[model samples]
Target: MSSPSSTPAAPAVDRLRSWLQGRDLAVFHSVANRHWPGADPLLPQLSRSANHGLLWVGAAAGIAAFGSSARSRRAALRGVASLAVASAAINTVGKSAVRRRRPRVDLVPVVRRLKRQPVTTSFPSGHAASAAAFATGVALESGGWGAVVAPVAAAVAASRVYTGVHYPSDVLAGAALGIGAAFALRGIVPTRGQLPAPGRPPGEAPALPGGEGLVVVVNRASGTAPATASLVREALPLADVVEVAPGGLATALTDAAGRGRALGVCGGDGTVNLAASAAATHGVPLAVFPGGTFNHFAYDLGIETVQETAAALTAGDAIRVDLGRFRPGPNGEDGADGYFLNAFSLGVYPDLVRTREHWSSRIGGWPAGVLAAFHVLRGQRPLEAELQGRRRPLWLLFVGNGLFQRVGPAPGRRHNLADGLLDVRVVHGGRTPALRLLAAAVAGPLTRSPAHAAVRRRRVRIAGLAPGTPYAYDGEVAHSGEELTIDKLPEALTVYCPMPL
Candidate 1:
């Protein structure tokens, strides 16, 4: 009997590694021995600190610590998220599927070696992956902020090769993986700041009588309103633009709604809430021009600047949206009728919002929120209230207008504008309040095993509460006596925006 011999398959990965060594080793060696010495001795030390993307973590933390604008702060948070995705891909999948040896330190100068080299497979550089991921994530939010980090990220990725730990091919693979992770995240998460989504066309919009028939109520007390008011006037020359002080904003919005063919307003979420309520009540379309701090509603509408909203108004791009309505007390007469275009929060949340506002301007929103959480938690006692017919000890409760997607332990943004439901999240602190709250804060609002519960419903009622209990909606706090009934008002308001309602 003659036996046939079959040829074994060649190791393509090994072959590629050899070719990369031949092509890239000389440059890597040159950089290590000669080029890197001219750089600060701290270069490799800095690279070592970047192990597991800790350096990127610190950088994003710093941005969140110092950045005041919601855009920059969100970019920082997204950067950390991207790093998580990229690193998980690299360590758990990318590296495991294709194992490759690290460059031999025999050729690397002692000065260029990492203090503590990675022990994992070196097929793709994890540091490079993290750097690219973080930078791309930031870029996806604000190009200006992304531009600031690009050079640092490029340097960090290059340092992996310069420190004689990875091949150029490894860095290339890592960067590609990182960029892919960022794009993948874009699909998974709800976001604004991307190219504005086209909403309902002009033909779908309700009629606007004329320039005089349209009225815009601008809150002069808003930090950015004075400047924004000029632009609104310039854009809609014949539209009646009224400058109202903050104290009288609600009444002014109601008055403007009564007279105008279409209602427009400028301010923060609180002011917008007033306008949205009026617009919804009067059954008129709303033209929202962002002219306040952290324009949550405007951002959700995909209207970043005043000019964009004004342009949309002129072009007649608009959509119908949801409004969260609640009777703050048993009857409308007992308390002011309440409505929110964003969210409503009770218990420790209102305190945190107020506390965060005190310091968020100086240190930035994320850091301030963190600081405020700690402060609020220390002073906070559970609010005993009836939730959906059950009596429970609740640390905090949030109800959003539409179905909101969770980011960490809280709702970040809504997936739909008029889903005819309220997104309800309740936090239960249990016996160890701090530990439970912190865990719940990070584990995510919708996780199955979470200390909190997230659900969607058309209505919720709370009874047996103390008189004039304070709650927050649209970033402003108010008192509601005894019982409250929160309900979803689907497509209750028409909003002019770039995004679909």
Candidate 2:
């Protein structure tokens, strides 16, 4: 067996190694070595204690004696029993068969200072195996609490490696064994209760019964947005609040349909896209509550303030909006094309998203915006693009359903969402240049100059673009495709808004 310092053979394994190296694991390992110098000697004995035996047995006993109800007690005991039996069989029988040695004990501080010697072979780490079994069992019992247990198991496994008592691969195998055992056990031990079937599939909306309840779809990560539940309670006291998870927008909408007539979504552009897709399919009137970082969708729709949007929802009126359908190129021959109700662009933006991780870390919004601007300015590059059905070779193309607030006097000034026409704005490289592009962006949305022109078209196609040209639709980059066809789905989506538009 190769040492942990040796390079991984598989591409996926190498990538995972690279990712781990970038995290704080290396520092954490060093700290563990410094604190627990004699930990290596205890690991073999620790592994023999039946894996997560100590934690699980203790928890099961506590729950059985003092749990609130018989159901809770039984669930806890069952989870513990499952993990214990699995851990014992795997650690004793499995490790005995495929005995492997620890990496050089003297290489790390924790191993070198071992007060007592270890006897068992270290191929499959008992510590990790036990942790995995316990965690998987707990996860099967309770999702929210299970999340907490799983990480502790991972940490125990990693500790084995940091202390130089078990090889990384040994811990990996132990984890797999434990997880498999837990899954096998769960097949026999059923969960306490049944959950309702998911209501809606993607692209379909739920049918609202009598149209009185308020359905809220929120992006939990969107900056400082009012909580969707709180907003719903304040604005529509009788409404139901539904939290939508990643890829759960359609289901949320479907579930909401039978409960309420009005649907309110509090999230970023991506959440808006999800709600919009479902609303359009179901012919439901939707309301937007901008909760994302940019609020680009709300901005395009002229819903600037969250308070104002909430007030409008309280008042209750519906409006029909146009939808954009993006048709990607066939055979992967051309750049990706799709319909966006807001704005679509290629270049700088996609690269920015790929690199920006500070958004989650920064407390206030200003820092994130400043960082985004810096990334855009520093990493900006020019790319050639051909508007297949247009007159010029374009550098940057922004297609929108509504007129952007004027950046300056640019050619495409009269873009309107309800006009049944798609607005196309193109920036030429030689005439406008990168500096001009930056200036135009800062000036505002409308740039009326010879270098930029806004043309109205019913259908538009873009092709002959360089590979990897980042195309952002409603702020998220589409996964893959080059050729794009943009067409309008007029009056397809019904939205709730304040009256007098």
Candidate 3:
């Protein structure tokens, strides 16, 4: 005897399923028979191009190549990643879970039907899923790019039904799954827009309409400088832009800061560091343009493009951020100093930077970094430094201007640029430098492991350095004295940034 619960629901469920299938077939037939003007030749080729995600791949490559900004690269990467997830899901589970057959194409026009039909079960259309995933992912990162891709994605989904390879229900289900995949990926690795703006206090600065009072100093040697500088000119036509050659950054920045209502800088972290120092000393608001291979300071500030910074400048949106300093220099309290806008590090990092800089112009930045890492890890010895009153052997000592948080595996950003704390991280002395560094990277910020430890402090002092021991700060390597102190200047620098929505 069948239980009441099981017997009653089985027939009802079967009836609903039959009803849905009939409706699905009706829609599929309607789409197949309908005449779509100009869709016959265009859609079939578009559908064919999207086979195995080749079209999306090509689109992503194009976006990355032409977009020429960090946001574009990120959008392309996110789109591809979302596509991968959606494709895997459709192949592994979605297709097999519901074995719905493809629709009959007799009603479909001969020219509209695909030459080669899909053979897989069609409960969820993989093409629709991939298209939705890629477009949704791109949109999540960049609205403009997403707007451009969404129509193509919708057309691809429509083509599945127009060609009679998938029912409307199949396409709908697949697109839903694809969108879900994009959101899931966003949850795993959030888009920059999702992150909160740096919790920094706002500062007062002049609203430069068309950047009338802003003076921008461009580092000619920095990555994409010419292109970005040209963008700056186009974006802020009234602003005075000074392009400085190598070894003349100090004079140019000093002069720019002294004269302008606000000082703007375009370059890498190292160049930004000099600008930040000049701005702070001259008591002027600073604007940053990301014209570098790695614009760590600018990206952390959420100023990814010249347009963003220009917008901030036009509106006078500014905030106070902490400045990192190491003491005992040519002049100042505690004997003058040098400043680092991003981080200060000792041990293998300095050597790696030196080596990478040496070879970067020759072999390219990424490969040079890899080669530097290999050379430094293989040849460099652990640093012997006195920290917190005790002498110890260490592989690295990193001190950041503020507390840095782990985005995924390594420390990627800081949420509070004005926080009066130094993020101090260290990897203990070890035999295999590569393993220790890798372990530290995997360990992440504020987490301690057997190989590495991280802590936050108002001040950090390291001693017992050998004469002319190389240390790196903000991608610039230099020699240091026997003892060095790292500290923060709370809200000492004012920088322009777009206010978070």
lDDT of each: 0.77, 0.60, 0.89
lDDT of 3 by residue, 1-501 (tens): 877778767999999999998998898777776788899999999999999999999999899877867788889999999999999999999999999788876778899888898889988999999999999999999999999999999999988888888889999999999999999999998888887777769998889979899999999998787789999999999999999896999999999999999999998889999999999999999999998878988888888888999999999899999999998522224456899988999989999999999998786666799999998898678999998778999999999889887665678889999889999999999888899898888777787977899889988878788879989999998888778878888999999999887
Q: What would the per-residue lDDT of candidate 1 be over residues 158-191, giving only the tens digit for each residue?
A: 8888778887778989999999998888777634
> Which portions of model 2 show Cα errors greater than 4 Å?
1-211, 226-228, 254-260, 299-307, 310-315, 330-339, 353-366, 389-395, 407-416, 430-433, 442-451, 466-468
In the order shown, the candidates' Cα RMSDs to the true structure are 5.4, 21.5, 3.2
Which residue pairs collide in model 1, if any? Answer: 213-261
Candidate 3 least-lDDT 10 residues: 327-336
TM-score of 1: 0.74
**If both were scored by lDDT, which would come out higher, candidate 2 or candidate 3?**
3
Per-prediction TM-score: 0.74, 0.50, 0.88
Clashes of 1: 1
RMSD of 3: 3.2
Query: In angstroms, how far off is 264's CA in candidate 3?
Result: 1.7
**Candidate that beats the other on lDDT, 1 or 3, i.e. the better one:** 3
Q: Worst lDDT window (10 residues) for model 2?
A: 195-204
Q: What is the clash tally of candidate 3? A: 1
